[model samples]
Target: MPLDELPPPKVELSDDDWRARLTPEEFAVLRRAGTERPGVGEYTNTHTEGVYTCRACGAELFRSTEKFDSHCGWPSFFDPSHSDAVILRPDDSLGMRRVEVLCASCHSHLGHVFSGEGYPTPTDQRYCINSISLRLVPAED
Candidate 1:
Protein backbone atom coordinates (compact mmCIF):
# COMPACT_ATOMS: atom_id res chain seq x y z
CA MET A 1 0.00 0.00 0.00
CA PRO A 2 1.02 3.61 -0.50
CA LEU A 3 2.03 5.83 2.36
CA ASP A 4 -1.24 7.66 2.40
CA GLU A 5 -3.20 4.43 2.21
CA LEU A 6 -1.62 2.60 5.10
CA PRO A 7 -2.87 2.78 8.62
CA PRO A 8 -0.87 4.25 11.47
CA PRO A 9 1.17 2.14 13.86
CA LYS A 10 -0.72 1.48 17.05
CA VAL A 11 1.67 -0.44 19.30
CA GLU A 12 4.08 1.09 21.79
CA LEU A 13 6.49 -0.28 24.35
CA SER A 14 8.72 0.87 27.18
CA ASP A 15 12.47 0.34 27.16
CA ASP A 16 12.32 -2.21 29.95
CA ASP A 17 9.40 -3.99 28.35
CA TRP A 18 11.21 -4.21 25.08
CA ARG A 19 14.34 -5.55 26.69
CA ALA A 20 12.34 -8.18 28.47
CA ARG A 21 10.58 -9.24 25.30
CA LEU A 22 13.53 -9.36 22.93
CA THR A 23 16.55 -11.59 23.20
CA PRO A 24 20.03 -10.22 23.83
CA GLU A 25 20.86 -10.17 20.13
CA GLU A 26 17.54 -8.64 19.19
CA PHE A 27 17.87 -6.00 21.90
CA ALA A 28 21.39 -5.24 20.76
CA VAL A 29 20.31 -4.53 17.20
CA LEU A 30 16.79 -3.18 17.67
CA ARG A 31 17.13 -1.23 20.89
CA ARG A 32 20.82 -0.45 21.11
CA ALA A 33 21.12 0.33 17.39
CA GLY A 34 23.73 -2.32 16.85
CA THR A 35 24.30 -3.99 13.48
CA GLU A 36 24.27 -7.70 12.83
CA ARG A 37 27.01 -9.43 10.88
CA PRO A 38 26.45 -9.09 7.15
CA GLY A 39 25.10 -12.12 5.26
CA VAL A 40 24.15 -13.87 8.48
CA GLY A 41 20.69 -12.45 9.03
CA GLU A 42 17.84 -14.96 8.97
CA TYR A 43 15.92 -13.21 6.22
CA THR A 44 18.85 -12.18 4.07
CA ASN A 45 17.99 -14.71 1.36
CA THR A 46 14.31 -15.22 1.98
CA HIS A 47 12.12 -14.50 -1.04
CA THR A 48 8.79 -15.70 0.23
CA GLU A 49 5.55 -13.79 -0.02
CA GLY A 50 4.82 -12.24 3.37
CA VAL A 51 4.77 -9.18 5.51
CA TYR A 52 7.76 -8.31 7.65
CA THR A 53 6.76 -6.91 10.96
CA CYS A 54 8.73 -5.29 13.73
CA ARG A 55 10.33 -8.00 15.84
CA ALA A 56 9.92 -5.93 18.94
CA CYS A 57 6.34 -4.81 18.49
CA GLY A 58 4.86 -6.88 15.68
CA ALA A 59 3.98 -3.74 13.75
CA GLU A 60 3.80 -4.20 9.99
CA LEU A 61 6.89 -2.81 8.31
CA PHE A 62 7.78 -4.27 4.91
CA ARG A 63 6.19 -6.56 2.38
CA SER A 64 7.83 -9.23 0.27
CA THR A 65 6.59 -7.49 -2.89
CA GLU A 66 8.93 -4.61 -2.16
CA LYS A 67 11.96 -6.80 -1.51
CA PHE A 68 14.73 -7.27 -4.03
CA ASP A 69 18.08 -8.94 -4.33
CA SER A 70 20.77 -6.30 -4.01
CA HIS A 71 23.42 -8.84 -2.87
CA CYS A 72 24.21 -6.31 -0.18
CA GLY A 73 24.54 -8.98 2.55
CA TRP A 74 21.17 -8.21 4.07
CA PRO A 75 17.49 -7.94 3.39
CA SER A 76 16.73 -5.13 0.95
CA PHE A 77 13.44 -3.48 0.25
CA PHE A 78 12.81 -0.91 -2.44
CA ASP A 79 9.82 0.48 -0.61
CA PRO A 80 8.07 -0.11 2.69
CA SER A 81 4.67 -1.80 2.81
CA HIS A 82 3.44 1.42 4.31
CA SER A 83 5.28 4.71 4.22
CA ASP A 84 4.30 5.43 7.79
CA ALA A 85 5.59 2.10 9.01
CA VAL A 86 9.23 3.14 9.01
CA ILE A 87 10.84 6.33 10.27
CA LEU A 88 14.02 7.69 8.72
CA ARG A 89 16.52 9.65 10.74
CA PRO A 90 19.94 11.08 10.06
CA ASP A 91 22.64 8.79 11.44
CA ASP A 92 26.13 10.16 12.05
CA SER A 93 27.52 7.14 13.83
CA LEU A 94 30.61 5.13 12.82
CA GLY A 95 32.22 8.30 11.47
CA MET A 96 29.79 8.33 8.53
CA ARG A 97 26.49 9.88 7.60
CA ARG A 98 23.55 7.66 6.69
CA VAL A 99 19.82 7.60 6.85
CA GLU A 100 18.63 5.22 9.55
CA VAL A 101 15.35 3.30 9.39
CA LEU A 102 13.37 2.49 12.51
CA CYS A 103 10.04 1.04 13.48
CA ALA A 104 7.68 3.94 13.96
CA SER A 105 5.64 2.21 16.65
CA CYS A 106 8.42 1.12 18.99
CA HIS A 107 11.33 3.25 17.78
CA SER A 108 13.55 0.24 17.21
CA HIS A 109 16.38 0.59 14.72
CA LEU A 110 15.77 -1.50 11.61
CA GLY A 111 18.85 -0.47 9.64
CA HIS A 112 20.17 2.16 7.24
CA VAL A 113 18.80 3.27 3.89
CA PHE A 114 20.91 4.35 0.95
CA SER A 115 19.62 6.13 -2.12
CA GLY A 116 20.78 6.77 -5.71
CA GLU A 117 23.25 3.93 -5.65
CA GLY A 118 22.09 2.74 -9.08
CA TYR A 119 19.61 0.08 -7.98
CA PRO A 120 16.89 -0.31 -10.60
CA THR A 121 13.87 0.06 -8.35
CA PRO A 122 10.79 2.21 -8.30
CA THR A 123 12.14 4.32 -5.42
CA ASP A 124 15.79 4.28 -6.43
CA GLN A 125 16.48 3.59 -2.77
CA ARG A 126 17.56 0.54 -0.85
CA TYR A 127 16.24 -0.14 2.61
CA CYS A 128 19.14 -2.15 3.94
CA ILE A 129 17.57 -3.88 6.90
CA ASN A 130 18.49 -6.45 9.51
CA SER A 131 16.56 -9.67 9.79
CA ILE A 132 16.86 -9.51 13.54
CA SER A 133 14.82 -6.35 13.42
CA LEU A 134 11.97 -8.00 11.57
CA ARG A 135 9.63 -10.99 11.92
CA LEU A 136 8.25 -12.54 8.76
CA VAL A 137 4.53 -13.37 8.61
CA PRO A 138 4.11 -15.47 5.51
CA ALA A 139 1.12 -14.80 3.35
CA GLU A 140 -1.71 -17.31 3.52
CA ASP A 141 -2.30 -19.09 0.24
Candidate 2:
Protein backbone atom coordinates (compact mmCIF):
# COMPACT_ATOMS: atom_id res chain seq x y z
CA MET A 1 0.00 0.00 0.00
CA PRO A 2 1.06 3.53 -0.65
CA LEU A 3 2.24 5.50 2.37
CA ASP A 4 -0.61 7.91 1.87
CA GLU A 5 -3.26 5.21 1.51
CA LEU A 6 -2.84 3.38 4.75
CA PRO A 7 -4.28 5.06 7.81
CA PRO A 8 -1.71 7.01 9.76
CA PRO A 9 -0.22 4.94 12.51
CA LYS A 10 -1.84 5.63 15.84
CA VAL A 11 1.45 5.88 17.69
CA GLU A 12 3.30 9.15 17.49
CA LEU A 13 6.82 9.77 18.74
CA SER A 14 9.05 12.64 18.00
CA ASP A 15 11.80 11.51 15.66
CA ASP A 16 14.56 12.70 17.92
CA ASP A 17 12.92 11.26 21.00
CA TRP A 18 12.38 7.87 19.36
CA ARG A 19 15.93 7.90 18.07
CA ALA A 20 17.26 8.55 21.54
CA ARG A 21 15.16 5.79 23.00
CA LEU A 22 15.86 3.07 20.43
CA THR A 23 19.10 1.87 18.93
CA PRO A 24 19.78 2.33 15.24
CA GLU A 25 18.77 -1.24 14.50
CA GLU A 26 15.61 -1.07 16.58
CA PHE A 27 14.56 2.19 15.03
CA ALA A 28 15.20 0.80 11.58
CA VAL A 29 13.07 -2.27 12.12
CA LEU A 30 10.40 -0.64 14.26
CA ARG A 31 10.02 2.78 12.68
CA ARG A 32 11.81 2.86 9.34
CA ALA A 33 10.20 -0.28 7.84
CA GLY A 34 13.26 -2.46 7.78
CA THR A 35 13.55 -6.22 8.25
CA GLU A 36 16.14 -7.99 10.34
CA ARG A 37 18.00 -10.97 8.98
CA PRO A 38 15.90 -14.13 8.99
CA GLY A 39 16.49 -16.58 11.86
CA VAL A 40 18.55 -13.95 13.62
CA GLY A 41 15.77 -12.59 15.81
CA GLU A 42 15.96 -13.22 19.53
CA TYR A 43 12.69 -15.14 19.67
CA THR A 44 13.36 -17.50 16.79
CA ASN A 45 14.86 -20.11 19.09
CA THR A 46 13.28 -18.89 22.33
CA HIS A 47 11.29 -21.63 24.06
CA THR A 48 10.77 -19.92 27.35
CA GLU A 49 7.35 -19.69 28.93
CA GLY A 50 6.00 -16.20 28.43
CA VAL A 51 3.94 -13.87 26.35
CA TYR A 52 5.20 -11.88 23.43
CA THR A 53 4.16 -8.27 23.72
CA CYS A 54 4.69 -5.38 21.44
CA ARG A 55 8.01 -3.75 22.10
CA ALA A 56 6.74 -0.28 21.27
CA CYS A 57 3.53 -0.62 23.22
CA GLY A 58 3.16 -3.48 25.64
CA ALA A 59 0.06 -4.96 24.07
CA GLU A 60 -0.08 -8.72 24.35
CA LEU A 61 0.17 -10.21 20.90
CA PHE A 62 1.26 -13.82 21.23
CA ARG A 63 1.64 -16.48 23.87
CA SER A 64 4.47 -18.97 24.14
CA THR A 65 2.01 -21.83 23.97
CA GLU A 66 0.98 -20.83 20.47
CA LYS A 67 4.55 -20.55 19.24
CA PHE A 68 5.94 -23.20 16.91
CA ASP A 69 9.05 -23.88 14.91
CA SER A 70 8.17 -23.25 11.27
CA HIS A 71 11.87 -23.40 10.36
CA CYS A 72 11.16 -20.26 8.41
CA GLY A 73 13.89 -18.31 10.25
CA TRP A 74 11.35 -16.35 12.27
CA PRO A 75 9.09 -16.71 15.27
CA SER A 76 5.94 -18.40 14.01
CA PHE A 77 2.68 -18.63 15.86
CA PHE A 78 -0.50 -20.42 14.95
CA ASP A 79 -2.66 -17.68 16.30
CA PRO A 80 -2.39 -14.36 18.03
CA SER A 81 -2.99 -14.11 21.73
CA HIS A 82 -5.71 -11.61 20.98
CA SER A 83 -7.42 -10.59 17.79
CA ASP A 84 -7.70 -6.89 18.49
CA ALA A 85 -4.03 -6.48 19.18
CA VAL A 86 -2.96 -6.77 15.57
CA ILE A 87 -3.74 -5.34 12.14
CA LEU A 88 -2.94 -6.75 8.72
CA ARG A 89 -1.95 -4.78 5.68
CA PRO A 90 -1.13 -5.88 2.19
CA ASP A 91 2.58 -5.47 1.65
CA ASP A 92 4.00 -5.43 -1.87
CA SER A 93 7.67 -5.04 -1.29
CA LEU A 94 10.65 -6.61 -3.03
CA GLY A 95 8.29 -7.52 -5.88
CA MET A 96 6.28 -9.96 -3.80
CA ARG A 97 2.91 -9.66 -2.11
CA ARG A 98 2.61 -10.53 1.55
CA VAL A 99 0.48 -9.66 4.53
CA GLU A 100 2.19 -7.38 6.99
CA VAL A 101 1.32 -7.52 10.66
CA LEU A 102 1.33 -4.42 12.80
CA CYS A 103 0.48 -3.56 16.35
CA ALA A 104 -3.04 -2.15 16.52
CA SER A 105 -2.10 -0.06 19.52
CA CYS A 106 1.13 1.49 18.28
CA HIS A 107 1.15 0.46 14.62
CA SER A 108 4.64 -0.89 14.96
CA HIS A 109 5.49 -3.44 12.31
CA LEU A 110 5.37 -6.88 13.90
CA GLY A 111 5.71 -9.19 10.88
CA HIS A 112 3.61 -11.24 8.50
CA VAL A 113 1.00 -14.00 8.63
CA PHE A 114 0.44 -16.75 6.07
CA SER A 115 -2.26 -19.35 5.64
CA GLY A 116 -2.77 -22.83 4.15
CA GLU A 117 0.06 -24.36 6.09
CA GLY A 118 0.15 -27.62 8.01
CA TYR A 119 1.06 -26.62 11.50
CA PRO A 120 0.61 -28.80 14.56
CA THR A 121 -2.14 -26.56 15.87
CA PRO A 122 -5.82 -25.94 15.47
CA THR A 123 -5.33 -22.95 13.26
CA ASP A 124 -3.40 -23.52 10.08
CA GLN A 125 -1.99 -20.03 10.28
CA ARG A 126 1.62 -19.06 10.53
CA TYR A 127 2.40 -15.71 12.02
CA CYS A 128 6.01 -15.09 11.12
CA ILE A 129 7.08 -12.44 13.58
CA ASN A 130 10.22 -10.42 13.77
CA SER A 131 12.21 -10.97 16.92
CA ILE A 132 12.93 -7.29 17.25
CA SER A 133 9.22 -6.52 17.23
CA LEU A 134 8.50 -8.36 20.44
CA ARG A 135 9.47 -8.47 24.12
CA LEU A 136 8.95 -11.72 25.97
CA VAL A 137 7.60 -11.48 29.51
CA PRO A 138 7.95 -14.71 31.41
CA ALA A 139 4.80 -15.96 33.04
CA GLU A 140 4.74 -15.37 36.76
CA ASP A 141 3.88 -18.21 39.04
Using TM-score as the measure, which candidate wins?
Answer: 1
lDDT of each: 0.89, 0.85
- The C-alpha stretches of model 2 lying farther than 4 A from their native spots are 1-10
Q: Write the per-residue lDDT of candidate 1 for residues 21-135, one digit (tens) a residue.
A: 9999999999889999999999999999999999998989999999999999999999999878888878888899899998888778899999999999999999999999999
Candidate 1, overall lDDT? 0.89
Candidate 2 local Cα displacement, residue 18, angstroms: 1.9
* Number of the predicted model whose lDDT against the real structure is largest: 1
**What TM-score, to 2 decimals, does candidate 2 have?**
0.89
The digit string of per-residue lDDT tens for model 2 on 29-137 reads 8777788999799999999999999887778999999999899999999989987878888988889989998887777788889988777778989999889989999
RMSD of each: 4.9, 1.8
